[model samples]
Target: MEIIGFIAATLTTAAFLPQVYKTWKTKDVSALSLPMLLMFFVGVFIWLIYGYYKNSPSMIVANAITLCSAFLLIYFKIKYAKTP
Candidate 1:
């Protein structure tokens, strides 16, 4: 059960990578809306806070990675926003 939970968390959380990679490789955040990214970052932050409050290591780790990935999108949105 624990292994399954870890696997689920890892896979789902790692799902943010492809989008990040695309943004990194293409430097294209045009299709990525700023408000949407902001909302996602906020949601991830809330999930991290919830995980901390609940003392769930898996949740914390997963949310932390998610937050970082979302933040990367936000960063790219801000950095290369006007380009394309």
Candidate 2:
């Protein structure tokens, strides 16, 4: 069951990477909503805390990686907005 959780977490969390890569490669954020990104970052951070409380390795790992991507998106949004 825990293996299943880990697998599911890996798949779902990894799914965000392509978008991160695309954004990194192209640096285009005109289509991304800042509000959505902020919400996602906050939500994943909360999930990280929840995972710690519950002692869930899957949740922690997934949220940790996802948070990285989320932060990247936010960083790009801010950093790229200045480019003309």
Q: Over the stretch 33-84, how does candidate 2's per-residue lDDT look in tens digits?
A: 8899999999999999999999899999999999999999999998887545
TM-score for candidate 1, residues paired by index: 0.89
RMSD of each: 1.7, 1.6
Runs in model 1 deviating more than 4 A are none
- How far is 11's C-alpha from truth in model 2 (Å)? 0.5
Question: Model 1 clash pairs?
Answer: none
| True lDDT of residue 71, candidate 1 | 91
Task: State candidate 2's TM-score.
Answer: 0.92
Report the C-alpha lDDT of model 1 over 1-84, residue by residue, as the tens digit. 456657877999878899999999999888999999899899989988998898788888888899899999999989987843
